[model samples]
Target chain A: MNKIFFFLGKGGVGKTTLSASLAYYLREKNKTVYWASIDPAHNIYDLLSLPASPKVQKIEAGLWVEEIDVDRYLRRFLEHIQEKAQKVYQYLQILNLDKMFKVIKYTPAMEEYACLYALKEVFKKHEDKDYLIIDTPPTGLMLRIFSLPFVTELWLKELRHWREEILKRRQIVAHIKHVDFGPGAQLEFSKDKVFNELNAQQKDMQYLKDVFTNPKKTFLILVINPDKLSLLEGKRIVETLNKFGIPIKIVLLNKTGHSMELKELNFFNDLPQKKIPLFEGPFPKQVLLKIASLWVEDAYL
Target chain B: MVLKQIKDFLSQFGQGFKEASIDQIQRELEEMENAFALLICGSLSGMPAPPAFLSLCLLPYMERELKIMFSKTIFLDDKLAVWSDLVEL
Candidate 1:
């Protein structure tokens, strides 16, 4: 099993910085680590001072980084649909099937589904890597991404009904044309392959859900700046995650001044979790190393 | 056509409602309608409909409408207007 770590919180709470630092720290331990950002409003490249690309550029001896190319993922998903449609069309002598494929490729939840597909691919291919750290999007979209399995399952049920109706219509059309309907003709109309693929994808999602919900395999660190609004938002995040049965292992109080006392931390009394104090500063490599040391101590010890 | 789509969408929920208490179904439909209204009004007003807004806009309307009828209400977003089959959903 691969060790997956997600650094998530509201925007501008040093998630990217923390994720980058962790990746660096893990690399120093001679562990293979890949750090990627999934936020649309990305600054991982800027933070790392690297160009935007899909290739995992070597940041250090054991550390690698990449930003997810959503457009590339979308294109690949569309290509997969086109390829499947072409296979059917070549065998069945059907023309203009690309239009339907295009429509399906652009449906609601399609982009999210494509992203999930990419995740599955990443998990499979990067099994050799010791750690996979992801800097996710802001709370709302991140929640949607994590809860995608439930939404996709609901949509799949409706789609299965739609597929059956399409099959019935196709059968009627075949009858009217006086075509010789042979065995396995129903396979053309049956989106069972697609459904099966979706099921497989769901399994991958379940794996992630397990990783997210499991305390040992995964750790969710909610990063927050020391401010009233940010603290309230952090509280809401914890509450919402609890409602959805997501286990929040740690709360990261980022950008705090030296005046704050860790012993006097009463803001998160409701949460039965550890609060790690990360002081605010220029955030140099040494500072990040200090943060990583804290993380290793908190997580491992 | 829009009306037909609304009717179709309602019918899907109707099947689910068979197992649900009448009050629960009515409340759920009203909640759905409220969500729809908020999406429309917020989008029109150039404001993003946050999660709290969904609950705030829909919950009261649902509670009030549960007293009237078991009718399911549907609102179409402008973005979904192009889908011919969506009218039935």
Candidate 2:
């Protein structure tokens, strides 16, 4: 139920720097803020000069920063799976199922699922905060993460049917073995445990979708530089968000070198026009502050 | 103990699972197809994972998929592999 702000764009557009400064500015206004980075590259530490730890680091009066360590999260998630699977294995007397599950846990989406699970935990546990600002990964990965609830839902449906069939098959096997069909039967063939955890995860994804799709609560600010590639990328992002039904609240053009001519500026007119002045120097605290002030002025209006 | 409680809680939704509609399944399949298409296109174009432009194109389909996936209750551990595959996208 808290307001969530996402600073998203292609990489190298100062999304992290902008997000950090904005969080700082919001804190100055006496609002409790939790600025989290969902980027796998882990640049928030270097940008903010904070230690690489998951616990919130107080940067100002009411602002705190945290980074999601995907690997660690994945390790923990896999460990949970291993623990649960071990319980099932021990109960069923199945040999080597644990090893097979370990291999499955190492698959590609495992890390992403772990990261998302971490996001769900944070949202659920950190309810007292006023603002939650997210520094998402670049557009593509971030979109996949954002859209995961949708994609996973389809898989879940198919999986439900498949699981039921598997359960039925297990029951037949139990019958053939003349095993007593009693309370232990539930433990032997139940899909309820796995489904419940997934349901919880889907709820988290739904929370994100609700927040993201709502213009009043979640604002997607696209960050861009004044170059052909970045500008084109920004335009594409704008269009993509619209296509996905996620609102794009504003576009922040960062780090435009002072040498561009008037004709070059014409390229930006094609975009949904909200422009912030370009800073000339490196993205130090002062420059970040300036950007943050501009963002606050624009975002509030 | 928490895990057991969670399982017991989810078993309550098992009845609804029997009532899934075909239209919902078809709609979800379409969404997955679109997402897969977008990912393929983005990868071919060398675009990053959250390709801004293409993701916009994929968002609605993605949203549809989300709605379908979450409406009926499914457990987490069983679908971890499916989720892992999608996240890799």
Candidate 3:
């Protein structure tokens, strides 16, 4: 399994820049790196000065970059839903669900779930890569995504239990009738479509939850500025992660000016903090490369 | 004639048991399905729902239960929607 690294922070706090630098640093160590961003703003491509494309483009020999297009991702996801629905309920073909899905685009939490689905797709698609660097959405949205797997797993477990009960009842009826309730049983619930779907979903959710909570396999790197507001947001994220039991590998403090003293930040006192000095102009490859070199030397947690 | 009378009596008794158990089982299954629907798509029923995307993902499996959930009306005494049905729809 690949080691997953997530760059999380408040907006405009240099997450994309740091992600790019980290990816470069990892690639320099001869590791195959896949750097993907789900940020709607597509700042990763801008940071790399690469032309935007939906497909993964190779930035260097071992480094690949891609911006996940959530619209395309959601469309495919809906298509998958439609296909499964039509297969399970043959009458679904007449429902015009394709048009109905257009309305789902505006639903709450759709984007975040879609992003999660897309991230899973990306990881599955590039299984050969050794390292995966993710530049996630802004802090608020990112935290919501972090909390999603646990909530979804809980729901899946409850659903699976109900499905199992229904199947047990069907089995009991089959026993009373002394009928071979194969796929051709009167209720045909032994080969239950719903039960099968719930079973598959349960397994998928379990795997995702394991992936998220495993510290050795996943690292959530929180990025913050030296300012008060950014540190406060970072503190909130750390608290949330701590609640979720997600390991905080490192807290990156970006854009620290010469005058700011790291010793004064009490909130980050318990966590391992890495401070990146504020730069003069727009972040260029050379500047990012220099930071990448320094990062390798600093022994990132 | 005596044997036939005894056989008919036993068949009727067996039929009653079968029908009663089937009814009980159907009711239990329906209740379980309804609770499952509420858990999955509670937003439509006015509860705090999870992600809509997840609900949609589970929609294919819940087609029948979803039908029941949407069709059932909350009566005034139903406690589920305590304030609802106060005004005529």
lDDT of 3 by residue, A1-301 (tens): 7888899888988888888888877776799999999988887777766679988899789888999898888888888887877776675466777677788787878888878788777878888999899999888888888788888777767766777786677666666656443332234444676666666766766676677788877888888888777878888998898887887888887888745665436877788777788765566767778876654443442
Q: Which runs of model 1 end up more than 4 angstroms from their true locations?
A: A86-108, A154-184, A187-195, A258-267, A270-284, B1-89
TM-score of chain B of 2: 0.29
Candidate 2, A91-186: lDDT as tens digits: 445446546555645654555566667777777666789888889877777766666666665544554454355345445444444443233223
lDDT of 2 at A241: 71
- The sequence of per-residue lDDT tens digits that candidate 1 reaches over residues A1-301 is 6577888788888899888778778876788987887777778778755677767777777777778776577677666555654554455454465565556455555566555656666666778888888888788767766677555445445434544553454444454444432333342543434334434544665666665677776667777776766677677777777765786767777767644544334567654443347555556677778777765553441
Between candidates 2 and 3, the one scoring higher on TM-score is: 3
Q: Across residues B1-89, which tens digit of lDDT does each residue of candidate 2 receive? A: 99999898788576355323332443354344334433424444465343222222222223323333343224445677656655454
Most TM-score-accurate candidate: 3
Better of 1 and 2 by lDDT: 2
- Cα lDDT of candidate 1 equals 0.60
**What TM-score would chain B receive for each of the candidates shown?**
0.29, 0.29, 0.67
User: What is each predicted model's overall lDDT from 0 to 1?
Assistant: 0.60, 0.61, 0.76
- Clashing pairs in model 3? none
Interface RMSD of each: 18.2, 14.8, 3.9
Clash pairs, model 1 backbone: B5-B87, B5-B88, B9-B89
Question: Best lDDT goes to which candidate?
Answer: 3
DockQ of every candidate: 0.02, 0.02, 0.34
DockQ class, candidate 2: incorrect
